[model samples]
Target chain A: MGQKLTPGDSRSNLYNPQLGMTLIVKTVTRWVKGFIFLFGVYIVLYGHLTPGGGFAGGVIIAGAFILLTLAFGKEAALERMSKTVASEFDSLGALMFLMLAWLGLYFGGPFFVNFIQRNLPGKRFHLFSAGNIPLCNIAIGIKVGTSLFMVFIILSVLRVVVKKGERRMVQMKRRGE
Target chain B: MVTLLTVLLFFMVVGAIIAVETKDLLSSIICVGAVGFGVSIAFLFLRAPDIAITQVVVEVLVLVILIRATISRDVTAISGDREFFSMTVSIALLLVIFIFGLEVFKSFPQFREPVFTTMSDASTNTYIQRGLIQTGAANLVTSIILDYRAYDTLGEATVLFTAILGALAILRAKARKRTTDSSEGNSDQ
Candidate 1:
């Protein structure tokens, strides 16, 4: 639990729980998380042209959040992305991907067809050349990233319960009463 | 190249053995990660960059999740008859698999030869020739996954979605159980 704030006391650091690792870890994580997130976006956006795609990029993005949780504690990470928001993002990503596929059915011939005009004023190896592939990658990236982070957060928040006898024995030893 | 592959394979096998035999959970996880990385390197050497990338990222996520889930658990070493039996069974299975794989490999073409040498008009040739023109993507792998075999990719996405939903439901149910247990304890008091 975090420290409580009095009426006149500063509100800063009052809500962040004591759950993270050491100071060095927090500092390193702070510096690295942004770069990792940016790298993930890069992977997602350039999925068609690059080696990685949505799933790999999404996992990298989730890795950034996991690093934050590991170094700065679950509370700090959750403050940045709560359970509700993560779930919503997960759902939205999935829906967006599905809708893209549906667009093929509605506008184009078959399911998951390359509906959009693929040649969009870009060179062969340039970005924005792939039609619906990039869009799909972005949607899958968001969905996978949020879902994975949600799993990590939920798993980390689980409390380990000690047996009643063990708890009582520890308390009695400490109190000697 | 063959020697390099042999060395990498040797390292992968060693890592796998250490992963299985290590008593410390964290060390075991690291060993498994090493094995995964070795596999990724093999993929890269084989010119499968896309698979290598996916493998590496998946390995990282798996390691992170496993460590988080097992951090608080007991790391007791498994010993005794059951462990011995399992080990024996696994060794036997591995030997059988090795023999069977060698037999299967004998039926296939030589490793160094081009795989498409059997047919002049094979689908692989067609894929390489027209993959970029039809799909308009520079990366052949992307075009194959997203356009050529889109139905398979759709199936994969569906499977991923289903897995996430299942995980969420299971975690939520566990939380509900904990809450009900706490409420019952309070009412009893």
Candidate 2:
């Protein structure tokens, strides 16, 4: 979402106001990111009755993280979180998704099969009543959020390290000792 | 159908402009991200969510690679390349693509077609129609990815794995060269 400030960045019109006033920036960005993220969640949750599903929701959730990165710098975005933690979250998401598929084996008759027993008393077309569809959405949300967070951290870190290395190489070449 | 495709083409043009004219490298990559999403939306409109998802995944990976490349690359506008002929060429290409799309849409059978019209009649009908029955999985796309086309899902996993590997190779290339240089320095000493 956001690019690292470069030597040429001074030429660009945008500024990193988030860095100076993070308290205000964080609040606003959180709302913006949260809205986008939740809307994706809603789409995935009700995908059975309408359009959208796990992958779409997952990407949208991840896009929210990209927004966070753009609004706040990488460190600020992960100030309370860490890379390994995000990776763990990603694994947990993948695991739970697998577990849901196995549930089909016990009740739905086979792997990846949806077995709706029609126990819901609510009328059709309502949220929370999409049988197993909402569950898939939840799984997708978790997997996407965590994995995307991990990707954000990794890419940001690489950018930082690469810039540092480039500076060092120049310094070494300058010193002819 | 023409309206849908026209809207999609509009998105493509905006995305191309963003990706090309944006001076900021990261934003440019993110512009590509925007293009990817738009392309997937177009795919969805075409009734191919499977391709859409796959396209999304691949494009995301491409964006990551682009971001990595931008760390060493610079973007500049091709001011000199902006000529009447080039503009004509681009517009002509876009018009051709639009015509081809419209032609394909025209070839599709009307909704009256019995077999292809209903979701239950499709090839993956076995897995897709399970949503109304017992499996409990609601999102047919999820069901397709995780169940019916599980093998394709595995292939997607492999694609991601390959992407991760490619990223590793790219990001580490400089470091590897640095390590080798340091080793050479040690021998020189």
**Fnat (0 to 1) per candidate:** 0.50, 0.16
- Each model's DockQ score: 0.40, 0.15
lDDT of 1 at A124: 67
User: Chain B vs. true chain B: TM-score for each candidate?
Assistant: 0.87, 0.55
Model 2 chain A TM-score equals 0.66
Q: Give the runs in model 1 whose Cα sits over 4 Å from its true position.
A: A1-18, A118-122, A159-177, B81-94, B182-189
Cα lDDT of all candidates, in order?
Answer: 0.78, 0.62
Q: What lDDT tens digits, residue by residue, belong to model 2 across residues A93-165?
A: 6667677768768874667654443445344556655455567557766776656566655665665232245
Which window of ten consecutive residues has the lowest lDDT sum in model 1 chain A? A9-18
- Cα lDDT for residue B107, model 2? 71
* TM-score of the A-chain for all models: 0.81, 0.66
RMSD of 1: 5.5
Over the stretch B87-110, how does candidate 2's per-residue lDDT look in tens digits? 899989999999999999887777
lDDT per residue as tens, model 1, B74-142: 433443335678879998999999999999989888887877777788777877998776666777877
